[model samples]
Target chain A: MWRDALLVGGKDLRIEARSRVALAQIAPFGMIVLVLFAFALGPDQSPLVHAAPGLFWVAVLFSTVLAVQRSVAVEAGDATRDGLRLAGLDPAGIFLGKAAAVGAQLLVLQAVLAAGVLLLFGARVVHPWLLLGTCLAGAVGLAASGTLYGALSAGVRLRETLLPFLLLPVVAPVLLAGTRLWQSSLAGGAPDAGASWMRLLLVFDAVYVALGVVVFGPLTEAA
Target chain B: MAPAAPVPAPALFLRGAVALSGRFPLLAGVDLEVAPGEVVLVEGPNGAGKTSLLRVCAGLVPLASGTVRVLGGDPADVRTGVRRRIGLLGHASHLYDDLTVAENLRFAVRAAGAPVDGIGPACERVGLVGRLLRTPAGKLSAGQRRRVALAALVARRPELWLLDEPHAGLDASARGVLGVLVAEAAAAGSTVVVASHEPELVAPLATRAVTVAGGRVVADRATPRPVSTAGTGVADVA
Candidate 1:
């Protein structure tokens, strides 16, 4: 299973590297969203700083949709999905491999978004460890849940419009927990407050990851 | 006393298999049995479910009812590992556009847990050696892409070969290469089932011919020879 996961994950990452779609298109789109957030909230840096966590996650959320879309789109052409199915790898491994690839891409996106928040919003990081943990946890949750929904919507027409609707609602808990964790981490509040949200993110990640691994096979086969 | 000889299981066995696409039945009822080293040709018109049958055998499509056993196990049951020994070339080439021809074949072999050493020879066999192997699949012509897909299949050397429209995009030479490859695979004990609109290209090579219409098999016949040296003539199946 681990072998299949690494092979699949490596294949996806290599495709992304060659295509540069994530780097050129999705990442830049994320930066643009960041710039737009500042404009919409007015030129005042105070409002931007106050809304940094929400804006950052909002950007991540939207960009994640793009990333997931591209990831799934690569399989759309040809019978690539069927190819993966016929490879006979464990379905859980396929899920993990895809989620890992998406997680890796989102991490890069989040890193740039983080810098955007710090530089553009003038948001200072009070606890770097806490902030990094929240980002990693949130990214995992997003990748897991996003990949599950992506597979669900893969065979459907109008999936482009359908995916965000399916993914955004299901991912609300992650958004809520991620936002609160970011707020607590940046504020340097009591470690317990951050810990609670961190626990929430961890739970979210575990639940979706498990769900993805269990359901991906049947879902993909059904399609 | 002489020891009892063992009987080999059929490479593919389907009994009253029914499958659907949404509300419509794609395979209302399909019963087929293909022996080891047999080459079966599936011919049908558009919307005739030829592709779906191959997909079903490959375990890419679910059967609504009835039993489908490929390589001695239910293909529907993924844990059986039936899929690992099956190579399917469907309507799409299944190659990543971003990956080079060589990379695509390598990926397929690796994914199927086959030896990576087969890559070089597979490419050569498919006439994709040297610079062509390095060319991205997205840049290749339709015929070239088909060759690459065939190379991947050759490298994997699956026990069961399920090819849907195998001759669709190939030129005469490539089509001949395809025929040779299919013949070689079956000669080596692999069972092959090909669904083609132009059945004549594969007709002489087929051990059996099955025709599907309205989601059911309407005809099944045995051919005179296991390997045909006849010229390509269009089979009037439609």
Candidate 2:
């Protein structure tokens, strides 16, 4: 399973490297999302600073959808999904590999957005560990759920619209926990207050990742 | 009563198999048995369920009802055991657009647990060498992409080959290479099932022709071609 996971993970990352869709398109889209939010909240730095944590997570959330969609699109045509099914790779491995790829991309995006929050919103991180932990846990939760929902809607014609609808609601917990945890990690915030939200984010990540590995085969086959 | 004489299990078997797509019956009922090393050609007009037949055999589509088996096991089984031994070249080339032709073939071979070293020779056999090998699949012409798929199939060397419209999108020379490949696979004891509308092209390679209509096998018969003519003519074309 691990071997197949590495095979599939490497394949996805290689495709990303060649195409640059994630780096070129999706990453820019994420930055634009952050820029747009800052504009909506206006030139007042105080409001922007208070809203930085939420806006940062909101950007990550939206990017997760696009990343998952891109991941699905890689196998969308040429019966590539059917080919993978026939290739005999373990479905669990395929799920983990895909989620890992998305996680990797999300991690990079988070770093960029983290800097964006620091620079644009003038927000300061009081507890670097808590901020990092929140982003990592939130990214995994979002990636796993996004991958699951992406596969569910993969066969549908309305997947473009359906994915966000199916995915956003399921990943709301990550967004909520992420926002709260980020808030607690910011300057003039209580670091100890984030423990519950951090645990919540971890639990969310574990549940979906486990569920994705168990059900991805049947889900994709049905799709 | 004396024990019944034992029979070798066919490489592929379908008994009263029925498959559906929504309200439409893609395969009303298909019963087919293909022994090892027999090249069976599935000939039919458009929308006659030929593609569905091949998909069903590959376990891409589940049978709504009836027993179906491939390679001595259920193709629908979740285990990769049966799927690993089967190779399918569907209408879609199944090549990742971003990856080069060589990368696609290598991935397929590795995924199928075949030796990756066969990729170089397989590419050469299909005439996919030099710039074409490094070209991304999305950049290749239809014929070139078909050659890539054929090369990937060759690299894997599956026990059962399910090809749909194998002759489409290929130049005469490339088609000739495909013909030789099919013949060689059969010669190597692999069971081949080809679904095609072009009967004349597949005539020399197939040992039998099975006509499909409305998702059922309407006709099945032998087409015994002289080995010397098929081999020599295809060789000359190649």
Candidate 3:
């Protein structure tokens, strides 16, 4: 299973390296979303600083949707999904590999957005460890849940609209917990609540990742 | 107690296979049996369930009610086990567009747990060499992409070959190469099932012909001459 995961993960990353869809398109789209949040908050730096954590999490959520879509689109071409099914790779390994790839892309996107929030919104991290932990936990939950929903919506003509509908609601816990944890990590924020929200994020990640590994094979069969 | 004498099961066995797509029946009560070392051709018009027949045999489609055993085990029950020994070249080439020809074949071979050393020879056999091997699949023409798919199959060397329209996009020379490859696979004891409209192209390599129409097997017959002799004029068998 580990060997198959490595092979599949390596294959997906290589495809991303050549295609540059995440680098050229999705990442920039994430930055644009951050800028748009600033526009909505107006010229007041105080409001932007106050809302930085929530806005950043929202932007990452949207980027997770796009990243998951891109991951599914890799298999949507021709009979590539069928080919993968026939390739005899372990389905759990495929799930983990895909989630890892999406998570990796999400981490990069979050870093860019983090820089944007720090520079543009004037928000400073009081506890950098808390901020990093929140981002890591949030990205894992988002990637795993997003991949499961992506597989559900795959092969559907309306997946473009269907994915966000199916995914956004399922990931609300990540968004809420992520926003809360990010809030506690920022300056002049509540530090005591950080540990609980981090726990919530971890729980969400474990549930979805486990569900995905067990169900992905049967889901692909139906898809 | 001594183990029972090993008996070779039919490479493929299907009886009363019924597959449905939505409300419509894609395969209605089709029964097929293919022995080891036999090359079978499936011929029919559009929407006649030829593809569905092959899909069922490959275990891509779940039989609504039937018994199917490919390599002596029901593919649905032992999916990865059955699939590992079956090479299916469907209508689509199934190549990753971003990956070059060599990368695609190498990935496929490795995924199938086959030796990657055969990739070089397989690519050469399919006429993908030098610059062609380095070119991304998305940049290759339709015929070239098909050749890449064939190369992956050759490198894997599966025990059972299920090909749907195997000659669709190939040029005359490539078509001849495919015919010879099919014959060679059969000679080496691999059972092959091909679905094609141009039966004449596959006629020389196919030892038997099966016709599908309205989701059922309407005709099954053996070619008059041996497949190894470059036989001709068996297209009308169906």
Q: Which prediction has the highest DockQ against the true structure?
A: 1
lDDT of 1 by residue, A1-223 (tens): 7898898899999999999887899889999999988989998888888789888898999999999998889889887887888888888898899999999999999999999899998998887888898889999999999999999999898889999999998888878888888887666676578677788889999999999999998888876
TM-score of chain B of 1: 0.93
Candidate 2 lDDT over B14-47, as tens digits, reads 9999999998999998999999988998999999
Better of 2 and 3 by lDDT: 2
Model 3 regions lying over 4 Å from their true place: A188-192, B1-7, B77-80, B229-238
Each model's TM-score, in the order given? 0.95, 0.96, 0.95
User: Per-residue CA lDDT of candidate 3, range B1-238, in tens?
Assistant: 9999986788999899999998899999999889898999999999999998888877778899988889887666434478778899988988999999999999999988889999998888778999999999999999999999999999999999999999889887777778778888998999999999998878778889999999988999997656662633222221
Alpha-carbon error at B208 in model 3, in Å?
Answer: 1.5
Task: Supply candidate 2's per-residue lDDT for B48.
Answer: 95
| Candidate 2 root-mean-square deviation in Å | 1.9
Predicted chain A of model 3: TM-score relative to the true chain A?
0.97
Q: Candidate 3's residue-wise lDDT over A17-87, tens digit each?
A: 99998889988998899899899889999999889999998999999999999999999997888887777
Error of 1 at A104 (Å): 0.6
Among the numbered candidates, top TM-score falls to 2
Error of 1 at B141 (Å): 0.9
- Model 3 misses residue A141 by how many Å? 0.7
lDDT of 1 by residue, B31-97 (tens): 8899999999998888988888888898888898998999998777779999989998877888999
What C-alpha lDDT values do all the predictions have?
0.87, 0.88, 0.87
